[model samples]
Structure formats: C-alpha cells, structure tokens
Target: MPRILLIDDDEQLGPPLAAYFQRFELALTQALRPSEGLALLAQGGFDAAILDVMLPEMDGFELCRTLRKTSDIPVLMLTARGDVMDRVVGLELGADDYLPKPFEPRELVARVQTVLRRRRTAAPAELDPDEWRFEGGLSIAPTRRRVLREGTEVELTGTEFELLLLLAREPGRVFNRDDILNQLRGHEAELYTRAVDIVVSRLRKKLEPLDAIKTLRNAGYALALRRLP
Candidate 1:
C-alpha cells in the first residue's frame, strides 16, 4: 500500500476518506495542522501528500514551500476556491497537482493516483544506463531519480527531475514548449506550457554555477552539457 499524508483540518472529511482510500490500496494518515503534518513527514515513509489550502496556522501553500526545501515527495493541493491562480501558484511552489474543494472523493483518489504515477514512472530506456554522466560535473541516476553536481547530490522536485531528464536525453536539441508539454504530460494544454516554464526556471536555479541548460529566443530550451566518458 502507498502511504499518503493528508494535511487538512477537515475533521468531518478525514475519517471516511481514510477508510475509502484503503479500498484503493492507499494508506492515509491525517494531520490536523501544518506543524503536525511536517513532523509526520520528517519521520519519513510517506509516498505522497494531500495538502489543504485553508489551515489553522500556516496555509497549505506555505507548508508546501517549506516541505519542498527538504522533500520532493509528490504533493497534491486542495484549494477551497476554484481559482486558476490558486492552482498556478501551487504549481509554481512545486505542487504536482491540485483539486478544488467540494470535490468528489473518487475524483480526489483519481488525481492522487495520477500524481503518484507521474512520480513513479521511469524515463525511457533510450536515455541510456540507469546512471548518466555529463560534462561540467553533472550526473544523473534515473533509476534512483537523483542528480549530482561534482559528487554532491542536488535536490529537485519530481517535475524538475523529469524536465531535466527529458532535455538531457537529447543534448543540444531544443524542445519547444508544446513539445515539452506533450513529452512530459502527453497533452498540449496552453496553461501547462506556462507551468513548464516555471519548472524550467526552478530547475535552472537548482543547477546554478554550472550552466547546463540553454534557452533559445522565440524557440525553447535545450541541455547544453556533453556526455562525459
């Protein structure tokens, strides 16, 4: 069973939802406060998280931002309002997906599964060995889902890792926005193209001082590193 941490203060919603999740092979652990949720997450063993936007102290967005500093576990945000900006902000903060409040429990489960699937999926074998080494002190271990710069591990969100892997697979090949969206998510939603840019920007920040990705004006982005023998 996949362990899931649910950080929401909905007393009436948690118990029944926990029971329902068991039917789908998901183990749900509910935390009533952001601090409690952070504590539970620090202890490890969670596969993903379901965070609510409205909370007692720190809101879900704040918690998500703090959590990203230490953990890359997939996050699915629950927003009380159906605002696109809320979803966009959550994604910018490293959330994997979002669902509006008053959502069907079944739909929530489906969204959760989708987020988990994206995290669990492996990069194509055409990318080469489980481990990839590149010039400029860069290396990637796909099976372990890790990136290293000069022997030091670089922390990256799931989306960032996928975006890096996709570009690194074809060094010097500029992938346009729509191409990236299709390759990563299998659909060309314009809204998500912007999300891709945010992810790329975040990825570049994490890969600083080594300049591995290059941008093309009016085109797209490409990996600028050469494979190291």
Candidate 2:
C-alpha cells in the first residue's frame, strides 16, 4: 500500500478519509498543522501528500512552496471554494493536482490515483533511451526520470519532469495546451488549459540558462535544443 499524508486543520476529516482510502489500498496519515506536516514529511515515508487550502500555521499554497524547495513528492491540494484561481495558484506552486471543497470522496480518490499514476509513468518505450543528451549540455535519464544541466543535477517536480520529457521527446514538434493536459491528466484538459503554461514556465525556470524550450505565438511549445551526438 502506498503511504499518503493528509494535512488539514479539521480534526474530523482524517479518520473517515483514512478509512475510505484504505478501501483503495492507500495508507493515510494526518497532520493538523503545517509545521507538523512538514516535520512528518521530513521523516520521509510518504509517497504523496494531500493538503487542505485552509490550513493552520500556514496556508496550503505557502506550505506547497516551502515543500518544493527540498522535495518533489507528489502533492494534491484541496481548495475551499473550488475557485479557478485557487486551482491555478496551486498548480503554479508545484501541486500535482487539486480538488474543490464539497467534492465526492470517490472523485478525490480517483484524482489521487491519477496523480500517482502520473508520478510513476516514465515514457513511451521507444522514446525512453537510457539517457538523452541535448546540444546545450542538458541531459535526461529516462529510467531515473532525472535531468542534468551542464552535468549539474536539477531537481524537478514530478509534473515538471513529465512536461520536460514530453517536449524533449519530440524536439521541435509543437504541442498545444490540450494535448499536454490530456497527456498529463486525461480528465482535466478542458478545464485546465492554463496548467500547461504553468508547468512549462516552472520547467523553464528550473532548467535556466539552457534556453531549452521555445513557444510559437499561438502555436504552442517545443524543445529548442538539438540532440547531442
């Protein structure tokens, strides 16, 4: 069973949610405050995290940003109002997925499973070379899903790595927003178009000085670097 951490101030939320998650073979651990959650995460047994937007000690967005500085654990955020801007900010802050308040337990479980799936899927067999090198001293190891810039390891969130590989695989091929969303989260494409841009921006920042990606006015993005021989 994959271990999952839930950080929420609502004392009533964890027990029932944990019980429900067991039905899907996920072990749920609870933390009532951001500090507690951060401490628990520092201990490092969790496979993923579920954060409620209305958290104590710190809001989920700040917590997510702080977490990203040191770890790339997949994160799913819960928005109290199901607001679009809230979801967008969560994505921008490195959350792997988001859910609205008053959501169905089943839907939440499905979203959790989807993010986990995205976390594990490497890439298409044929394109997954042991490692790929680009012209600007950037290299990607498909098996480890790791990236290096000028031989220096560049830590990336799961979503960021996935988006990077997606563009790197095709080199110059342009991928529109819907195509990326469908690849990232098949069910969220229509509602989360801006998500692709968010991931692209995040990925670009992390792989700085390489100029690894290019965007055509309304056409979309592509890998700007050529493969190393």
Candidate 3:
C-alpha cells in the first residue's frame, strides 16, 4: 500500500480528501500544521506527500526545502493562489507537481495516482554507459544521482535531474511534449508543456560554458553532443 502524507491547514478540505483516498489502497495521513508534518516526515517512510502552500508556522515551500535536504520523496504542492510564479517556485523547490486550490476531487485523485505511479516506475537504476554521458562536458552518474558538467558538480532537483538524463540518453532526438510527459510517466496531475520548457531552460543555464542541449524549433529539445566551434 502506498502511504501519502497530506499537510494542509484547510480543515474542511483535508478530511474529505482523506476519505476519497481511502477508497483506494492508499493510506492517507493528514497534518494540519507544518511542524507536525515535518515531524511525521522525519519519522520516515512515506511514498509521497501532498502539501499546501499556506499553513501555520512555516509554509509549504520551506517544508519542501527541508524535506529535499534528506529525502527524495515525491511532493505535490497545493495553493489557492494560481500564480504562475508560485507553481514555478514550487517546481524549482523540488516539488514533483503543483495543484491550485478550487480543484476537483477527481483531479486530485488523478494527480496523486500519477505521482505514485511515477515514483514506482522511476526508482533509480543503473544507466547504460552510452546513455550516461554527453560529449560536451556533461555526464550523469545514476548510481550517485548526480550530474557533472565540465567535471564540476551541478545541483539538480530530482525532477530536473531526471529530465536532463532522459534527454541526454537519446542525443539529438526531439521529444514532443506528450512524449516527455509519458516518459516521466506517473504523475496524474495536469501535465503542462510549459513545465517541461521551464525545466529545460533551467538545465541550459546550469550547463553554461558547455552547450549540451539545443531547443529545436517547434519540435522540442535535443541533447547536442557535438562541440560548437
């Protein structure tokens, strides 16, 4: 059974969501306070978490940063504010996905199932030697869960790292938005093509001085291994 910890201050929303998840094999736990949520997380061993942006004593973003320090447990952040900045910030903070408030219960369930499925399928595994390296100074160490550019370590969140590795694995191949989403495979939340673009943009900035990726016009992105003169 997959365990999910939901941290939200919305007294009305939590129980209903919990009840809904009960219908499935998922064991849903709710924490109304950030402190309590962090404590439960520290106790360990949850398959994933659903967090709300607003909370008493430490908001969801802070809690997410803290969690990423020690664990790679998948996180989905919820907020009433539907600002693009908030969603992007949450993604950059290591959240697997973000859901705005006023969402349908069925949508929430879909997102949860998607996240859990991705988690199960994306368990770290050994990478093929060919899939692990980029000629222009990029390399993925799957065993270490690290990315190196010009032999220097580049900090990447779990999602960002996975996106980079997936692109790098098949150099020069243009992956459409749906293809990338399917490749990511398991987060039932609404898939935004913009999210993929944002992740790729961030990776490009991080891989500066060694151009390892190129955006193909109207086609998606490709890993360019050949060095530019």
Highest TM-score model number: 2
Candidate 2 segments whose C-alpha is farther than 4 A from its true place: 188-191
Give the C-alpha lDDT of model 3.
Answer: 0.75
Tens-digit lDDT track of model 2 for 59-145: 999999999999999999999664888889999999988888988989988988987887788778888889999998999998787
| Per-prediction TM-score | 0.91, 0.96, 0.74
Candidate achieving the largest lDDT = 2
Which residue pairs clash within candidate 3?
Answer: 114-186, 114-187, 114-188, 115-187, 118-186
Error of 1 at 213 (Å): 1.7
The 10-residue segment of model 1 with minimum total lDDT is 182-191
Supply the global lDDT for candidate 2: 0.88
**Residue 76's C-alpha lDDT in candidate 1?**
88
Q: Assess candidate 3 and give its TM-score to the true structure.
A: 0.74
Write the residue-wise lDDT of candidate 1 on 190-229 in tens digits: 4576777788888998898889889998899999999876
Q: What is the descending TM-score order?
A: 2, 1, 3
Q: Mark the regions of model 1 whose C-alpha exceeds 4 Å error after superposition.
A: 185-190
Question: What's the lDDT for all of these models?
Answer: 0.86, 0.88, 0.75
